[model samples]
Target: MKRKSTLSRSTTETEISLSLNLDGSGIAQINTGVGFFDHMLTLFTKHGKFDLTIDAHGDEADNHHAIEDIGILLGKAFYDALGDKAGINRYAFQFTPMDEALCRTCVDISGRSYLVFDVPLTREFIGDFETEMLEEFFIAFTSNSKMTLHVASLYGKNNHHIVEGIFKSLGRTLKDACSIAAGNTEIPSTKGIIE
Candidate 1:
C-alpha cells in the first residue's frame, strides 16, 4: 500500500503544490523561495526518510505566506496519507543530541491536534528565517495533521544547533510513529478508531 497526497492552494497572494509519501527512501525536492527554510524542510524529509516534493510560489514580497502554507499543506498530506491509521505504531518519541545541543520530540497520531514547543533560541534569526517562525510552522502542522507533537530542547546554547537538533529529532520521532508494526492489524487504539 503506497500512500500519497497532493495539495494545492491559490489565493490572491500565493500558489503552492505539495506531494508526499509516508513510506519512501529519503528523497526530497523542495523550492519554497526562502533558502534557509527550504534547507530545513529538506533536512526534515531526508532525516525522516520520506519522499517529499514541494513546488511553491508565493508573494516574493512576503515569505510568511509560503512558509505557513507549506506547513499547512504538508500537515494535511500526512493526515491524508495515514488513512485509517491501521497497523501503525501511532506514537513515538526520540532524544537526539547534536554537538552540545540535546533535543527531544514526542508525537502521537491520536486524531487530536496539540503542540508544545519549548525551544528557546539565543538569536532572533537563523539566516533569513526568523526563529519565531518555527513555532508557527509546528502549530500549522499539528493543527492540520490532528496529532499531538511536543518538541523541547533540553540543552543548547547555539540557536542553529538547537533548531537543527529539534528538527532531526522530530523527523526520527515521526518516522517511528508512522511505521507499520508487524503482527498488528488493528488501529493502535482501544476506541477502534482514531477520529
Candidate 2:
C-alpha cells in the first residue's frame, strides 16, 4: 500500500492545501508567496525523495501566517500518511552541509511532539522569509505530526546556508525514519503501541 495523504486547512489568516507521497521519487510543486520558503520546501521534497504539493495563500503583508499554516497542513499530511507506523525504522539522523554551514537533524516518530531547534540564525530575515519563523514552522509541524524533531546548526556564517542545510538534513532524516524495515511487522517501540 502506498503511503499518501492530502490535507487542507483554512483560517482567517491563511488557506493551504498540501499533499504528500511518502514512497515516491522527489517531485514538488510549492507556492506560498514566499520565494525562499518555496525554495526550501522544494529542496525538502527533493532531498527526502517524497512527492509533495503545496498551494497556500495568506496575508501577504505579514507572510507569517502563510508559512505557519503550510507547516501545520504538511505535518497533518505526514501523520495521516504514516497510519499506524508499522515496520517503520522510526528514528533517523542526518547531517547536511552547504558551503560553511553544517546542520544536523534528527527525527523520531514516537507519537510524541517535541522540538529542539538550536540554529543560531541571528538575522531578522533571509530574503522575504523571517529567520525566526523557521522555529515557528517546525514547532507547528512537530506538534501536529506528533513527532520529536531536533535541528541544530553546529556552525555557520551565512544564515541562508545554515537554514538550507537544516531543511535538507531534516528531509533526509524523515526519509530514513519513515522507511519500512524489511521483515518487521511490529511497531518500533517496546510498549507495543506507538502514539
Candidate 2 local Cα displacement, residue 32, angstroms: 0.8
lDDT by residue for model 2 (1-195), tens: 679998899888998888899998999999998999999999999999999999999975688899888888888999999998999999999989999999999999999999998988889999999988999999999999999999999999999999999889988999999999778878899999887
* Candidate 1, 103-182: lDDT as tens digits: 99999999999999998877877888877888998999999999999999999888888888888888889999999977
Would you estimate the TM-scores of all the predictions?
0.96, 0.98
Q: Residue 94 CA error for candidate 2 (Å)?
A: 0.6
**RMSD value for candidate 1:** 1.1
State residue 134's C-alpha deviation in candidate 2, in Å. 0.2
Quantify how close model 2 is to the true structure by its C-alpha RMSD in Å.
Answer: 0.9
What is candidate 1's CA lDDT for residue 187? 91
User: How close to the true structure is residue 7 of candidate 2, measured as C-alpha lDDT?
Assistant: 86
lDDT of each: 0.88, 0.92
How does model 2 fare in lDDT? 0.92
